[model samples]
Target chain A: MKKLKRSARLVEMTQYLLSRPHTLIPLTTFADRYGAAKSSISEDLVIIKEVFEDEGMGELQTHAGAAGGVKFIPKMPKDQALIFAEELCRQLQQKDRVLPGGYLYMSDLLGQPSLMNEAGKIFATAFADQEIDVVMTVETKGIPLAYATGAQLNLPVVLVRRDHQVTEGSAVSINYVSGSHKSIHTMSLSRRALKEKSKVLIVDDFMKAGGTIQGMVDLLAEFDAEVAGVGVLVESGEVESEERLLRDYVSLATLAGVDSKSKEINVKPGNYFSK
Target chain B: MKKLKRSARLVEMTQYLLSRPHTLIPLTTFADRYGAAKSSISEDLVIIKEVFEDEGMGELQTHAGAAGGVKFIPKMPKDQALIFAEELCRQLQQKDRVLPGGYLYMSDLLGQPSLMNEAGKIFATAFADQEIDVVMTVETKGIPLAYATGAQLNLPVVLVRRDHQVTEGSAVSINYVSGSHKSIHTMSLSRRALKEKSKVLIVDDFMKAGGTIQGMVDLLAEFDAEVAGVGVLVESGEVESEERLLRDYVSLATLAGVDSKSKEINVKPGNYFSK
Candidate 1:
């Protein structure tokens, strides 16, 4: 790369940092890339850092010392996140989304990359402080949300398959009762998918009676992995407190009620916004 | 938002453009956000555009006129994309990834956000010129890759479920023969999931006899949609040329052969690299 002017360097540096979130890059890397001095790189970073903070894009953490550099920690400010969550609640409340069995159709919302990306940013923000080694989610609908969070957190995503497949190699399978339907289902994970004793962050598109999430929690025990955190895009608020299989999770929206006959749906911002 | 310094504005402008790819943003939006003149915003975009192109980040397309703005079209240099494809081929060639029945375990590579993002860039670059409205793929394995491609192309992703779900409402299902297994399997998509006559870009993780890709193409026909393009991460080289179900698709890597007894997996860059 040839030497670039400060303006070009700033734009490139901002892009480099944005693309590689949660990874530390040495100042010298930028210095070398631009054919500039360390002091000049530092000055450029200071300007970038201020804009990031001021705009609430995220935090640029700089470490001092011979081996130190900077890391970009992506974050969504609480106020902005609240607004986005409220907007999601409104979207989820559409009457047509109600299904025959009181189920709400959310596949359309989950299919939107920009929407999922925003939700991922919120989940990433919610769990930024946790020591999460990987983002875990079930197969099917949850995959997109899981990947979204993983992208923002710069962590690899591990998917739990609903049925065992030969292509997965050796795997651990477990049976758990679905809380909503009271039906037994099997979920499995490849042995090589997750490391032993890894601090895992569980994510899902929706949680009903918390059975699937609890099933995942139980499955994690087989791998000697710890549940660092759990986050969901939506949670069913109709589940009785005692009937819910798990507690202590973050949700962006809560499905309060669904009247299939009347085609009425009620949704509100999830517990993410504490009143 | 208050007015920012020129350096700060440039940094903010770059971040904004990178985050919203392929979407046109009027210069007035930036001008208002930074409380700057349109002339100043134009100058800032010039710097960002030059850096984006020079660094192979992508291209910033500017449209002039009242409704005109700028759109970020992500691209990966052909040489760099080939290098990445070669690296992926090497990773897929590992003996441990060779499972029984000649199936290669690639969940690990697909789980990586960074790697998938890079692959997404390559696929996006491959289909950037196509008239694509949405990205389509099957359930489970292909969801991540589809979403990644969707993110890069600034498009929505529609998933085809293996089994129809009640929550999906009315759906159109079709049974397609599995290319490699020679077994019939059902794949369905919700009627409401996609608009009629959409231009669709099909993406998948693997293709053998192109049965699954063909299945998606068949399903698109039901919706009166057009197949704008097709991209796969890996394609099987063992499939007889005459027996292949589909033609004219892009692949990043090719699985030349898999020796189950000796556990030798031969892999190479796919047709993406003409040479």
Candidate 2:
């Protein structure tokens, strides 16, 4: 009960050609169950079709007859990091989004779009195979869950704003000290909105004292880019995590605080729809 | 070539099998080219598979083969209501999203998500067919294009909040005047979000002076529910659309005022993508 190799059948055939729509699949049966060759599974289906057509979900087509293959059509899949952690754990398990001693009045799930499209489809299905291209957030409310994780990974959602206006021409800006540090917010970005070593992902909706995720990890290392992962919707299990850019995440609901006569709140459980 | 009768080829084959996804088709070639009766083309493919799974893109797989034939798989395709009105008129014809007079700064494209996932796949392809259920909006930025049009119409995204405290036991307040006169907001829902008559759609990202889209059309008429169309992203062509209550929108760009020279701004085109 364990025969799955060839880069794990090309990541389960690129997540079953990305969960259905125009389903197709050939390349000599993924080059006969990855025994390889069909030009090395067409160079791993051209790096999973250039990261799902540079992130806009569904379109891989590619056919050449005799029952050609490789289809994957149903668009909009990177799904803003699981619809922004399923609306940040359904707005931190609402009971009026708590706050006051338990904290959670997340400005109506960071100003709603159906709980950020199911928290950007569970944070774009937990980075459906990674490599991301862009999708970073940091501003007054992690720009709608980093534009729903650049619209479920079809990538291209920049913004860091807080000032430095004049139409984002040349800027990087930082500052930090938000969340309980007292004041100071800054941030800026748009020195061509990213592209050096590229890769990025970093999203946000809420996180406590981690100072706006270390002011967007020092503005993605001042644009050398390459963070790759850092999803967050609601996290603060006693703070601390930036744990070497936490690979994959989805706090969804996690407060574990408040009780002075039942401000209670407990929530937690969002490693991308664990159930 | 006007030879296309038979209820206009079954309404363009039920809109090309409702712009595809979970394909399926048959009922004797739509009852042998409308000569009728395969149980009246299986009750017109069960009212086009209950209006494309009540307008969420798709699913109608009924294969009781003798080598059956009812494959549609195209869900959400009213050509995405003209690709969400050409992506809300290319994000309201950017030039640095105007503002300050012609006001189109769209809170940074309503805190983007791949342009709210092509404005929620052009309003989930114009309510895919209609049965919706929920996906309303109203809050700081029509909650990321109403949760990317309720995650491609898979539905369930009710918000409406403005001010309804007491941990929300009862609510439905209204009152308008967005950029001037009368105000007051409150909405609150949670009696398990929605159901009575269901249907809904609402959506927003920016409309200005429709007065929060007419206070979310009077909080979906205090929950008798069933509005089904008022989508938006940007409207305010000096808002006075001869009385409001959205008639389905798409706007990616619009704003024709304050251009006496607030540095130049007029912008036009609002039905960006259409259904």
Candidate 3:
């Protein structure tokens, strides 16, 4: 590579660092790539770091040593996150979101990549300081949000399947009662998917009585993995505190109510703002 | 909010443009954000565009006139894409990945965010000029790949559920034969999930006889939608040409053979390289 002007070097370096979140890149890398001095690279990073902090994009941490480098920890500021969550609440409050059985249609919101990316950033921000080894989620609806969070945290996602499949090979299955329907359902995870003693962060699209998440917890026990944290996009406010299966978790929005008769729905920002 | 140095502006602008792919951003928007003249913004864009092109990051498209703006189109050059595909072939050829029924365990590979991001860029590049409205895939394994592709294309993703869920109100259900199992399975998509006449790009993790992809195509016909394109990570070479259901598609790698007894797996680059 040839030498580049400071402006071009800054642009390229920013792009490189943004794509690789949570990974350390030695100063020599930029210095060599742009055919510039290490001191010049350090100066460029100082400028990028200030803009990132001023814009609430994330924090760039620097390590000083032979193996030291800079790592970008992606984060969304509380004010910006609140604004996004409030917007989600507005979108969820639409009357048309109400289905026949008091269910809310959220597939459209989950389908939007930009929206998921933001929501993922919020979850990543919530659990940024934890020592998480992997991001876990069930099949289908929760997969996108899980992947979004995983991308930001630079973690692998292990999916628990609803039903056992031949492709998954040997698996450990568990039965947990579904809180909404009061019916027992089975969920399984492949033995090879998660390692023992792994710290897993669980994320989902929605939670009602926390039955599905509880099932995941039980399944994780079989693998000897620890539940590092739990994050959901929405949680039902109708469930009594006593009836809720989990005591500790995070949610971006809370579904207050859904009236099947009048086709009315209520939604608000979750406990994420209360912190 | 305030005017920034040229170097800082270049860094911030690069980050902003990279995040919002496929969306038009007017020169005035940048000018106002940085409190800079439109001419300075244009000059900054020229620098960013040159770096982007030199690094094979993507293309910065400029639209001229009153309603015009700049749009970022993400692309992965063929040489880099082939390198990634070959790396995938090596990973897939691991003997331990062979399962009881000769099915390779790919959930681990699909669990990787960085790997999926690159594959998504390759697919996005392949169909960059196509008139795509949404990226569609089946439940479970294909969800992440679909979302990855959707993120790069700046399109929403629609998932086809294997079993009808109450949450998906008034879905259109269709049964198709599973080519590998020779058994019939039903898949459904919510009526509200997709709009009529949508041009959809289908993606999946693997293809064997193209039964699942065929099912998605058949289901799309119910909505009067057109299949703009189809992409799979790995295609099964064991399936004879006569046994395959679909003709036009793209794949990153091909599974040549999987021996259950010897636990030997053969994987090669897909037709993507031949083009």
lDDT of each: 0.92, 0.59, 0.94
What is candidate 2's TM-score for chain B alone?
A: 0.36
User: Per-residue lDDT of A194-218 in model 1, one digit per residue for the tens?
Assistant: 9999999999999989989999999
DockQ of 1: 0.89
lDDT of 2 by residue, A95-201 (tens): 65554445445554454454664565566656656777777776445666777656555566766776775534557888877755557878788675677778878
- Report lDDT (Cα) of residue B96, candidate 3: 89
Candidate 2 local lDDT, B1-275, one digit each (tens): 22333333334345345333333455665566556667656655655555445444455667776877665433445555455555556555656655443444544454456566556766666566776767777644566667666655645566665656443334556655554345554555544356677778787766755667666766667777767777666566765655554555556546665453544555555565331
List the candidate 2 regions with Cα displacement exceeding 4 Å. Answer: A1-41, A49-68, A71-267, A270-275, B1-116, B120-144, B149-159, B162-275
lDDT of 3 by residue, A1-275 (tens): 68998988999999999999989999988888999999999999999999999999999999999999999999999999999999999999999989887999999999998899999999999999999999999887999999999999999999999999888878999999988778999999999999999999999999999999999998889999999999999999999888899879999999999999898888999999997
lDDT of 3 by residue, B1-275 (tens): 68898888898899999999999999999999999999999999999999999999999999999999999999999999999999999999999899987899999999998889899999999999999999999988988889999999999999999999988889999999988778999999999999999999999999999999999999999999999999999999999788889879999999999999999899999988997
- DockQ of each candidate's interface versus the true one? 0.89, 0.07, 0.89
In angstroms, the error of model 1 at B264 is 1.6
The alpha-carbon lDDT assigned to residue B207 of candidate 3 equals: 96
